[model samples]
Target: MTKRRGERPPVPEALPAPVVDAHTHLDACGARTPEQVREVVDRAVEAGVDRVITVADDLDAARWAAEAATWDDRVFAAVALHPTRTSTFGEVEQAELARLAGQPRVVAIGETGLDYYWDYAPRSAQHEAFRWHIDLAKRVGKPLMIHDRDAHDDILAVLDAEGAPDTVVFHCFSGDLPFARACVERGFVLSFAGTTTFRNARALREAARWVPEDHVLVETDAPFLTPHPYRGRPNEPYCANYTLRDMATLRETDLGELATKITRNAERVFGLRDAAKS
Candidate 1:
């Protein structure tokens, strides 16, 4: 079913336990202000999605994400220059990102990595920025959240070459079973987004089932992949419940049990010790 513009799907029944949206872009979802962020997060909470890591795609977005985290305890930030925007990466942007990455609210250095599907930046420039972000994640001792598109091979190769961070997550993972196995073998966490619920994403569903409970994660990637039945609509964290429920069905596990597992996995990867406090 296609979603109408400016329309949002109804919130699904809340899960037995809260689940974290491993990655989302609150700012892109039009939650640019503190009040707007709270509104969105509140709705998410009601749907059993209590925490989210809002990721930035550029310098301006990075600034907004870091600031947004301070507005609500349920929100955390991941700052980086997205692979598509790497064409503009330089000393000034890098320095600013480094500053944001050090903030207490900034828990990850990511939404970085390769996106070969878009030629917004040259391959060389994207590679350079990916290496830099990888190093930054390592230096900050934070997990690296990747945005791999059609460039899976290069994404893995670069991470291997740079010696990946202590923890790495493939945000909105779109790979097949073999690729999923490769990532899991390297100890990388795979975050399944709304796309996993789509009927056309058979391979992705297979990969989701293949992943171990500890290595699996869930996200909305909101305002983008809005999950099945609500595909093409504007998405928000609250909609994560749909994806979580679908994942549980795919794994043949109890929804509540899976929610608990995904939440625990998120806490571990993002080092969110105070997650429950929020």
Candidate 2:
């Protein structure tokens, strides 16, 4: 098959309760300007995805994320040099990220961790950057949102070695049951993206089911990982409903109840209690 392609999927029905996109890339999703960001967020709100944590993958993205958070009360930010871009990490980038980390709306230091899947950056450079981001998260007293791809073992090793922040989230959690258990034991939150809805992602579904309600979160990882039935389509924050609904089905929980629970989890992890209330 040539495979289907098109614009972002249509927004699903509003969730029974509001939830958060724990990790996403607004800039990459083409929401670069304030108006564009609001347009996207407005649609997300219509789908009951009331808030989001827009994450950065590089220095420029870090800047954009920080500013984007300020663009809307519903949007917060996570700043970091992604694993693939860690090769360019240096004093200048470090200082900028540090500055952005302290911004009022920047809630976490991340989308950072090991990614052995893409060899864009050497393992050594990724390791160094990951450790630095871990420390940065600690210094800022914010959660660390990790992006662990095919480097689960090393990601865990680094977290152990550097000691983790009080709050850590494995964004787009791709781990199987064992790894999920390990993360749960360590009290690290696992944010599931649309991939969990894939029919072939049986292990991921099992892991999601095994996760304690308190440790589970839902995200779209927007502009990527659109949920099943729309797997090849472009993703957006509004599509978070699809993933969360699928998650509810997989976990055998009430959709509204699960939405409320994940919303609480995101609030706790991102320190968004005030935002959640508003």
The top-ranked prediction according to TM-score is 1
Q: Model 1, which residues run further than 4 Å from truth?
A: 274-278
Clashing pairs in 2: none
Candidate 1 residue pairs in backbone clash: none
Model 1 lDDT, residue 89, Cα: 82
Ten consecutive residues with minimal summed lDDT in candidate 1? Answer: 269-278
lDDT by residue for model 1 (191-255), tens: 99999999999999999988999998899998899988888889999999999998888989999
Counting clashing residue pairs in each candidate, in order, gives: 0, 0
Scored by lDDT, the top model is 1
lDDT of each: 0.92, 0.90
In model 1, the Cα lDDT at residue 228 comes to 84
